[model samples]
Target: MGGNFLQSRSAIRHEVGQYIIRNIFASSGLSLYILVDTVFIAAAGGTFGLAALNISLPVFNFFNSLGLLFGIGGSTIYSINKLKDPKKVETLFGKLLLFCILLGCGFAILLNLFPTQILTILGAEGQTMAVALGYFRIIALGAPLFMCNYVCVNFIRNDGNPQLTMIATLSATLVVVFLDWLLIFVFNLHMLGAAIATLFSPLTSLTVLTFHRKNKQRQLKLKFAFPEPKTLLKAASLGIPSFLTEMSTGVSIFVFNWVLLKLSGNYAVAAYGVIANIAIVVLALSNGIALGVQPIASREYGKRNWENVKTAMKLGIQVAFGLACLLYFILVVFKTPIVSVFNHDHSAKLAQIAVNGLPLYFLSVFFASQNLVIMLSLAAIERAKMAFVLSLLRGYFILIAAVLIFAKFFGVNGVWLSVPFTEACVCALGFYFLTSALKNKN
Candidate 1:
């Protein structure tokens, strides 16, 4: 019995590790689409360009958030039902895909028609408004593509094709990198060039995902089924935590942009732009670990294999913390160089603010990493309400309150500290929820 237990633990670890490695690479590559844009845009357009991109990011986040809402939600359900009811899983893919495409197109039309109003609400003004409009308009055209790609990626990964998903994501990133440089520099398209390049990311990712249909192991079929309101609501309910998780970033950015613009004007917002983009990559790392564990945990839970589910969660938490430590260390030690990479025009003010903010803003990662794993673990075990509550507290309620209170007391430094403070509080809440979930299950 002891020997079997040891072997079981090892097997679970190896399986979890495999998913983690692939997901980390895929998530990191996906994040680079925007990171690359920041770098190239910095070189071509300077601080204003960076600010404009930052202002427009919430829109991008909104697109991705909705996709995850459907993607992760639907995929989690699919994973649970894949073996139990394969036919339901088949219809799920088609229904969600169609709904996402139509929803995305609606957003595209609205954004294109009211670019200025949206940009202004997001804190764009004057030169920033002018620069943002071009990028925003071009990016709006790809809304359907973005939503579809996200939905497909999540479904494919859950369908037991993570390798294909990783390949698709990395390939898309590489293509974006090359095109970002080509369009921004070679064509001197600057902000517009970067936007055009970004459009290809989802296009490339979706194109590559098409090959999943050929995989002999494939189970999901894309047969069109009109989405029933009941089915859509079920998926959305499961996915709300994920939706909030992604939207929290956009919402936080919108609030931060507004506050920062008020406190110190464009340069401060520019400084924040630098720190926020880096945070995207860090959060992506944490999210990768969560996503890696999600499929395994959900499947195990569906099987009622509590021990295996626990094993996956434990491994995820350990990896998340380890990566968090390493990332913070790198950010602390190499802060200058990292800031410089985004500071092409070399403004002293921008560099100073970003350097100071990097360490403080990043302290949140430790808690944020664990929060992600805990939230996803809850969701995996079908604890959607717990996950949703945690998501709301950390991503919105606690964060918004922390930012306002901290900014009042600490000024700019307080703004930076708000994230860490919020995450720490959420970490406590997440632990309570996770404990309650396990106790109830047992």
Candidate 2:
């Protein structure tokens, strides 16, 4: 079990692909539950209910920042372990476990104390505030469980059992969907029921996975002692880029929600919710591909396999771009039909926005997705600062600037256009850095 894994490619490929497929099911199922949950709530309580859930989007994503500590830090260290040592892998994993526990507690405190204030800041309105606040508080109570779900799956993926990771995910999704129907519909629990369902779902999944370690040939060491002084910080620093990139995406959606709310109202927000649910499917598939490549990129780079690194970059981008193009055609060509599925009454402004926004959104999605992959690839190979910078540019700074500048002049339309503009600029920067890095080494 402690031996070299490179020569184990024949077995690894079959295992990894299975793992990717399983995780894909998990992402797909979870996304579907979420879409359905919002739809069910809307039918029960209307757009206020939908907007209430939308308001919590940022907070949910921000919790993901905490989970990423293990995803990037522990996983990267684990992947390169054969080149380093198993003991170091054990230590890193141990330290990350402690990190998740402490951080999850901190988030629980923060979220519990600030539900209404935070929702207000995210642009929840007069009527939306009470509903959003109630829904958020209920959901916030489960932050620890949610964070654990993230850390566990990421660790399992790094543990060389991607399939188990996927199953754990499916278990969570199945449980959540069933419980949501019971809690929300049968019980008339409404937002509270939905929130509780979300909370208990992942908790159940985490519990089910505990039994799988009995067959484990590879052992992950857990240390109860305080991590070596800088280990926590070092691991977190490696994880920060991933943390920030993803969390900032939450901020982007938060902003989009606000703009959409003012521009087209709650109907638009609900329509956007449906559209976002669809996009999550794309994001999920893209993520599965990223997971497959991350460990390979990390390990190969450690061995100075520049050719493989370059090839992986091309292949990764090729797959992502092709997916984006396919989605673009679907949304662009079938805009009315897509919007009609969710609701068609009143000739809603939201339907028009969906039709307009989908095409523009995908224009730079390929670039954005590919750029995200490159960022993760660099990070996996222990190139933290560069990855961090690229993440910053793509996830935050440049896009914010573009959105602010154009949105002021263009109003609602300006906001919609910001995505492609920001993404194209970010991709140029990624290419520049990659080119320069290659030149400098030569």
Candidate 3:
């Protein structure tokens, strides 16, 4: 009996570790879509290009968030119901995929029709406006592809083929990187080339995901079904936290751009572009860790195996903390070189602002990482209200208020401190919710 217990524990750890490692790579690769774009665009068009990219980012975030709304939410529901109600799970992927396609098409049409109006609302103007228009238009056309790719990847991962999801993401990222160079440099397409390369990202990911059908263990099938209102609402409720977590980044960027433009100028916004993109990579890492814990926790929760659920959460928090520490150290030690990569023209103002903001802004990750794990864990166990509350506080309410007040009092440095302060506060609330929920359950 004792040996059996030990073996069970060991098996849990091994399974969780495998998910974490593969997801980190997959998530990081997904982020490179923007990170690599930032690098090449900086080289191609310099400050204006980088600043324009930042201005246009909120739209990209919106597309990705909508995908998560359906993908993560639908997949979480699928995971919980897959074993108990296999027939119900069959139509979920189909319904969610149809929902995303229709929703994505609507966004694409609107964005293409009113590029200038939308970009202006996002704070793009002057030279940045011209650069953003071309880039944003190209990106808009790929919305369906992006949303569908995300939906497919999430369901595939939960369907017991995380390895294929990892392969698809990494491979697509590699293709985009090469295309970024070929289109942006070789073809001299500049910003347009960069946007074109980005379109290839979802295309490649989707193509690779097609191979999932070849898996002998695969259960998910792409059956087309019109979404039912009741089912859509349920999945949306489960996915709202993830959607908000992502949109919060977009909303924060939109707010920050408005504030920074008033506080400093375009240079300040450009500096923020560098810091924010790096922050995206960090958030992706944290999300990867959370994603790894999610399927396991959700599956165990479905089985009513509370002990396994707790164990998975505990392991997730540990991994998040360790990775956060290492990431912060690396960011601080190499701040100058990192900033230089984005500051193509070596503008002193851009350098100084980004260099100073890198460490201050990144200090949030330590808390942010744990918050992500807790939020996702809460969602997995069907404690979505708590997860939504944490997401709102961290991404919307607390963050917006913090940035506004901090910038008013401390200027740009205060702007940098706002995220850390918000994450720290949210972290406290998250622990309270987690402890209360677990205590009640146990």
On residues 1-442, what C-alpha lDDT tens digit does candidate 2 reach at each position?
4244444444445444554466556555545556656656665556677667777877877776677755667677777774557766666665666667777788788888987787888888788887777778877777777766777667666666666766777777778878888888899988888888888666876886675576465455555555675776776777777787667667777877877777668766766665665665666666666666676667667777665556555566666677677867777798777766655243466567667767766576677766766677667766678878887877688877777787688866677678888878877887777656645543
Which candidate number would show the highest lDDT if scored against the true structure? 3
**Candidate number with the higher TM-score (2 or 3):** 3
In candidate 2, clashing pairs total: 0
lDDT at position 116, candidate 3: 97
lDDT for model 2 comes to 0.69
Q: Pick the winner on lDDT between candidates 1 and 3.
A: 3
Q: Output the TM-score of candidate 3.
A: 0.99
lDDT of 1 by residue, 1-442 (tens): 9999889888988998899889988887778798999999999889999999999999999999999999999999999999988876779999999999999999999999999998988989999999899999999988889889889999999998899889999999999999999998998999999999999998999999999989999888999889999989999988999999999999999999998988888988999999999999899989999999999999999989888889999999999999999999999999999999999988999998899999999999999999999998899899999999999998899999888889888889999999999999999989898988887885
Residue 66, candidate 1: C-alpha displacement in angstroms? 0.3
TM for every model, in the order presented, reads 0.99, 0.88, 0.99
Model 1 stretches with alpha carbons more than 4 Å out? none
| Clash totals for all candidate models | 0, 0, 0
Q: Which runs in model 2 stand beyond 4 Å of their true positions?
A: 1-23, 26-32, 344-347, 435-442
Report how far off residue 191 is in candidate 2 (Å): 1.5
**Between candidates 2 and 3, which one is better according to lDDT?**
3
Worst 10 residues of 3 by lDDT: 5-14
Candidate number that wins on lDDT, 1 or 2: 1
Report, for every candidate in turn, its global Cα lDDT versus the true structure.
0.92, 0.69, 0.93
How far is 349's C-alpha from truth in model 1 (Å)?
Answer: 0.7
Please identify which of the two predictions, 1 or 2, would achieve the higher TM-score against the true structure.
1
